[model samples]
Target: MCQWLASNPNELHLVNRMDEVGSSKSVNFDGARKMALKQIEEFLLSFSDPHIFSEAATSSAPATLAQVVEAVRIPEAGNLICSAAAIGKYVSMLQNPSSLLRACAAFAFVQFTLPGGQHAMHHAGLLQNAGASPVLRASAEAATARIESKMYARIVLRNLEHLQSSPSTQF
Candidate 1:
């Protein structure tokens, strides 16, 4: 299943449906779930470009990446932090001409800022930059609020303020 998923990342929706059905008490899909998660991690790490999350080349990629973010276990958080941070860089995609692409990029940033989102602090700085679009700014605001970490929130707020005061800044 993992090999198949790795070869066909776009088919993650099927696995998602399987997981939902397997969640019942009568089912024992623990092993399969674990294997799928491990495969997700491996697939992410092996992919040459972490920008896939931002690119949203396929209609399902954003949701699939969201599942990947949710599947990240605590023990391996450190190992995947860099990848999360890389994905966060795509927050700039919020400024894209296409609204659908912008929305997808915003969704990716929101996932990166969720609980257990390693390296979110690093991503906050990018969100605060002048290049960030209004969509990115709003998403960053939501992220900082959702994180509920005073220190991180403070940093993001400060950056937001800086960006707001600099009218000459370009997106």
Candidate 2:
């Protein structure tokens, strides 16, 4: 009985209190975890330029990473992107600490929901269900986020708002 009371949620809060812990240091998760996002970025780049995405892309080469900010705007690239990663997954990645990861995620979303994409409506529905609007807004306002990432997020948000307001003819 005493053990149950001691291990309650309220007790856990006391253990994590800022005063007791000295500081509430925030954690950034861009170590080995970054590899997963990097792999995804490389895969995204492949759709637009497969011949160039050779072994060099697989390396930690900084130059290739620089080009990741702009989304692959090719209409045909959309469905292919969806085949590799889901819209909901990228929507959730908006909160990651790595700015580049957030940027890539945002760009991927922009491509997924671009007006001419094959799965725009379906991806939009997935994004809607994942609550992407609020997430994208928050990403745009995040001070730690890169300007490119913020801009892409805003673009996606505007698209979503337009989708909600307009007729079913287009997204």
Candidate 3:
């Protein structure tokens, strides 16, 4: 059920809208926002189980990672990335052996480093941990190259190379 909703673009759009409306001061949309938030929270709670990926029978890790990436990609949903529970889940997934999971985690970091993502930056240290994978490095490099914001690109690049020698990261 969660996977189906996460994979649906239409549902994603509505979720994004709900986030925006929920944060606004308009009283008229309060009920709508609350309902939407409840649904989103329920979906997020699905990740609370540490073995969600391994236990799921229908969804592959990559697909689940993609769902996480999509959630983070939504501008209004940035709060989700900073949530302690969510961050723990993401960091755990980041360390997974699957290259796809690592890549998606890196993409989520990139999204978090962009404008209006200051809250999410608290988890930036996870990217520099000793377990950083080559796939993550590649994803960070690609994200740095593709981002239009110079400041954000530089920040992402710096995080990716924080501990590594400068010469090793040269283009």
Best by TM-score: 2
lDDT of 1 by residue, 94-140 (tens): 44333333333443344334433444454444555434445544643
lDDT of 3: 0.42
Runs of candidate 1 with Cα error greater than 4 angstroms are 1-79, 82-89, 130-133, 137-171
Q: lDDT tens digits, residues 1-171, model 2? A: 222212222322232242234444564333433454465455434544433333223443434433432334544445543422345456555765557657767776766666556666766767787778888989978877765566567667765665566577343
State which candidate has the highest lDDT.
2
| Poorest 10 consecutive residues by lDDT, candidate 3 | 144-153
**lDDT (Cα, tens digit) per residue for candidate 3, span 1-171:** 423322333443444455567668563565774575566445434433334323322343445534433333546434533544444444453444433333334444545544344443444544444343443444434532322121222334544444234343322
Ranking by TM-score: 2, 3, 1
- What is the number of backbone collisions in each predicted candidate, taken in the order shown? 0, 0, 0
Listed in order, each prediction's TM-score against the native is: 0.31, 0.56, 0.32
Worst 10 residues of 1 by lDDT: 144-153
Error at 88, model 3, angstroms: 3.3
In angstroms, give how far residue 167 of model 2 lies from its true place: 1.1
Residue 156: error of model 3 in Å? 3.9
The lDDT per prediction is 0.40, 0.55, 0.42
